[model samples]
Target: MTGRFVLQNVKTINGIAVDIILENGKIIEIVPPGTGIGDKIIDYKQKVFVSSGWIDLHVHAFPELDPYGDDVDEIGYKTGVTTVIDAGSTGADQISDLVSSYKNSKTNVFAFLNISRIGLKRIDELSDTSWLDEKELKKAISQYGDFIVGLKARISKSVVGPNGIEPLKIARKFSADTGLPLMVHIGSGPPDIREVLNLLEQQDIITHYLNGKANNLFDEKGEPLPEFNKAIERGVHLDVGHGTASFSFPTAEVAKKRDIRFNTISTDIYRGNRLNGPVYSMANVLTKFLYLGYPLKEVIDAVTVNAAVWLRKPELGRISVGDIGNLTLFSIEDESTLLQDSEGEKRMAEKRVVVKGVVINGEFNEC
Candidate 1:
């Protein structure tokens, strides 16, 4: 059975108007205005905006957990997000369940192999030497390497404490040995932000790149940390993982003013923050960034092509011909808004962008 769908006359952030055609779960063509017909047509009438489907690279959703507790499929299906990479919410022991049960049954899911055995539950330090099993980690990745995209380690002050840089050292070694990218959660670490960032190799990701707090990308002089610039120079990826306790207006504003371009934009969504303030949806994240001076096309790329590049899954993010039919339709709303970051700084936006529908694998799912 062939399923046909068309999105007509939608404006792109790049000032292009086209009709996108989806057939049998793949994008068949994108024709300039007045050129396509399909079984189903959505005439956006220039009112809707189009972009590549979003890929949230640093989410905390898991399938086995409650719908509220890190459920990847629920969030992805509901938020116009066709794909998401769970940022190390499940460790070696729990990955088997994820691969067998959740990975096969839900919205596209990928995971960063948590360095800890128990994952992020009931424990603060993931570097517990006793539970650190290299053998098990290797086995999990070897068995389920496709779904296991990379490694996740939270290098924050409250999480890692004053353990020096041993945890980071271990995570670095793991990434190096496995030949996979490292998704490092950066925020409040004690080893000085410079030292921690220096360890990140090329292609490694530094999430929460714009968190406003002590031990962040800024120094007392309000200039970016030396190592942060160094990492960028070395081609290290910067990711905006706006979590409940991450992302501040001060940080975002400063980064934007400095013209620091993030390699990717993502939501560090979890059970608690899904319905709360700043964590509404990826479109909201896009809106905040747009207000912060990033061009709309660049903002779209942050959540789409840029994120997919980091995951090494290039086909999942773009809407090019022959690619899976992952599409997002949005509208720009005129309004005044106040957004709060983790540090409680308030920022205002004059408009908000809202998603109208998502098409994943050519299947229509309206949100």
Candidate 2:
């Protein structure tokens, strides 16, 4: 994966035409088009768009797990996402294996360690608060600080069965202790959305920000809950974790009209959702946002810069000399393509974002 390479004549989201130069595993230089040379050059003569490689902040790509698992590359390199965070797919008991399996992967894989030590060993990891062993979690965080980017606590009725908000409280404490971000999942809540949002600090995230469930962001009149609005005002980030049952296009459209926008866009993609109707890929989920009328650059930033910033991995979000050589080469195909969100609402996309390939660690991979 180590080599010297150059991408020629590509435009960035901001409409700057530049030649990107890569050496070893870092971007050594960026110059005006036709002004850089390298040992191997990709003459991308067409006006394709280039940007820092995309990051899907909420995907479950640990293939060893059943049903919900998927191959890392399937959701990573193959889908134009260079970095994919496995959102609580594994916990302390299985983290070593999770990290070990991804060491040789072309796609950068990371995780928000599950609050439960058993980690998604079952569909309901948080049903019993006893599963959340602070002792084991602290040890794993200490051991895999670099690999464990954050902590994940699914705060919902089904997952948190009698425990209610205790799991989230534990996750917040762990984050406070380790100085890491915390990702809290919300759905059909026993610990109501307000309770969860009130507890979340600036860096903490609320995934599934827009769903059709009873506990959605909007009130009966389709107004943003005052509690939710205040949380955002206080700097809490809303993430579009478009999962199997989460993400309603009508909800998103309504929120958009209300001036509500998610900080990051993710698919929450796994084998079940990827193969099924809703989230085909990160690109697919991103396309839905485009359908919601987000500007191209703004949509791109959600998957790239905003995602990396909230995940606290500042190193993977930008394109510049001395930055990691992780780039996605893509084009907006001006065509009519059918797109659907998790709620079965459909739209005809005018410009579909098509992936040409990607540069990961200085090695170019074709889609």
Candidate 3:
């Protein structure tokens, strides 16, 4: 029920204690601890931290695809993520089905329309040039409008096959025509990472930037490549997709040492990675960042404010009066936890971020 409720004595990431009053799915007031009153009072007593709901910028939410699909809520609010962006799990041919599938879901869902008409029905979606149907792609974007946030092109070796950099070139043109940003997945590449980075304009995202693949953004010395620096200067966004095969602890360590940071932290998560190694949940992925020596605020912001700002939905990034009551309640537990990256490297974290519950659509769901 979208009832009046008071989340009392909850702490912000900055450690400020406050009471949040939510009514009819909107935040009515944020007051001093113990001051706000409502019909339903759920007091955290300053033990829980609240922030704008977590937004996963990259996920596979089309449950039909075998290797790269999942139920929306399975990776969303159930795991402290109130919103998820399906990262091109479907394209023109199947985006409608993907959209229809999530209509009854509690989690807020969006998608990046794949340039290929077939999408991830097969991993090498971009291998066929015929699947890059501009007409159908345009039609899907026009039909979905805002529901389709941007375009996603997996411009790696396996996904692109012998087509090389051609798919990305078309994707760039599509981005220009549609006025949408591109979220490009990078991995082992014969198209060459430099060519991919060169094609991306300002605001295009490079997911899996820290992957330890030979064709990664960093050089052999763990220093950023000239093209990578150029891409950063062009305002290309870096994302930590952290898929089952992406994300390397050593690569991440190098990035941390060199001060290379992610604009958004996402799990290129599907059923395999979520239930197996590496990316288990949003909290699990955040914990790895914590182990990398990032502060709680920066790590949390990667999934919250940073993602929201990129999505052009600033209202989803902060808690304020008159905004929708979308938030995640979590805590830092001082317990030793073992974390593993995609490379099978392990690190022991002394502290972990744990999700307690989430407030979405004016209703609270305990994790």
lDDT on C-alpha atoms for all candidate structures: 0.78, 0.86, 0.92
Number of the top-ranking candidate, with lDDT as the measure: 3
lDDT of 1 by residue, 116-152 (tens): 7677763465546545577888888999898888888
Please write out the lDDT profile of model 2 over residues 107-213, one tens digit for every residue: 98889999899988887898887788889998998899888888898888888888888888888887888888789888997878888888888878899998878
Candidate 1 Cα lDDT to native: 0.78
lDDT of candidate 2 at residue 266, scale 0 to 100: 85
Clashes by residue pair, model 1? 61-70, 62-70, 157-188
Q: Tell me how many clashing residue pairs each candidate has.
A: 3, 0, 0
Off by over 4 Å in 2: none
Candidate 2, overall lDDT?
0.86
Please give the TM-score that candidate 2 achieves against the real structure: 0.96
Looking at candidate 2, the ten consecutive residues that score lowest on lDDT are 283-292
Cα deviation at 87, candidate 3, in Å, is 0.3
Ranking of predictions according to lDDT: 3, 2, 1
- The better candidate by TM-score, 1 or 2, is 2
